[model samples]
Target: MAKILVVDDELGIRVSLWRALEFSGHKVTLAKDGEEGDRLFRENPTDLVITDLVMPKKEGLEFMSGLLVDFPDLKILVISGGGVKASSKDIELLLDTAQTRGAVKTFAKPFELHEILACVRDLLAADAD
Candidate 1:
């Protein structure tokens, strides 16, 4: 199983993601915000990062930028409640920025558990090369 880092400011979201990942047999790390996420990333290496788009400590895009700069091959998944469809310009920008930085997948909030699991599996499998 891949080691995953989940960064989100919402306590409920963090707990839910952690539980889901743990149930799927993946090693999971939870962070309250991007600052904590960065610190954890440095202290303990993770195979993939799953982060919320907008956060208080640091924006997810910024975190992804730094993480990608430090670890180019890093597989990342951007999750956002902001972008439901194509109309939300800010969400679109965030998604685009993350994609440019090497995020493998993007998931809109209220995402199904199966979808998240599938995305994680796909990303890790691809990384296995």
Candidate 2:
């Protein structure tokens, strides 16, 4: 099992993802915002991070970029709802920037739970090799 961090500003998003990841037999940590996520990651290094692109404090790009600066090969999966009415292009740009910043994969919010779980397992498996 891998230690995974789930970072998002929304309570429901965090809880649902936490439950899903835990159910998949991985240790899951929840953070309300990028600031908390960064602190938690520093306190306990995790195998993977799943973060939202936009948040109340610190934002995803800055948070993940900072971590990548320290751990260049860190695995990150990004997700974002963007603005309430965000255009698809906007989300694409946001996620693409995350990839440029260092995230290994990206997902738009309302993403399938199964898809995220599968990606998580895949990333961890790749790391294990």
Candidate 3:
């Protein structure tokens, strides 16, 4: 089993994702925002990171860029609800930037649980090789 970190601002999203990842047999850690997410990551590295693109304190892109500097090979899966303040086009642009910054995958909010689980599995399997 892989150690996975789920970083999100919404309580429901964080809890549900933590539950799903735990149920899938991976050791998981939860963080409410990128600031805490950054600390958690440095404290204990994980096989993968699934984070929301928009958050308070620090956004996913910022957190991710910092991590990439030190852990260039880190695997990151980004998710976003387009923020309450952002337009659809803004979200798309942000997600595109995340991809350029090294997110292995990006999912818009309302993405299926199955899709996430499958992507996690595939990424871990690929890493195993």
Model 1 steric clash pairs: none
Q: For residues 47-113, could you state the per-residue lDDT of candidate 3 as single tens digits?
A: 8999998899999999999999999999999999879988878888988999999999999887898
Encode model 1's per-residue lDDT on 1-129: one tens digit a residue: 889999999899899989999999999999988999999999998999999878887889888889988898888899887634545666767777778777888877767978988989888888788
Q: How far is candidate 3 from the true structure (C-alpha RMSD, Å)?
A: 0.8
Cα RMSD for candidates in order: 2.4, 0.8, 0.8
The number of the candidate with the highest lDDT is 3
> Per-prediction TM-score, please?
0.90, 0.97, 0.97
**Clash statistics: count for each candidate:** 0, 0, 0
Instruction: Return the candidate ranking by lDDT, descending.
Output: 3, 2, 1
Show the colliding residue pairs in model 2.
none
Candidate 2 TM-score over all chains jointly? 0.97
lDDT at 43, model 3: 97
Per-residue CA lDDT of model 2 for 43-79, tens digit only, reads 9999999999889879999999999999998999999
Instruction: Score residue 85 of candidate 1 by CA lDDT.
Output: 51
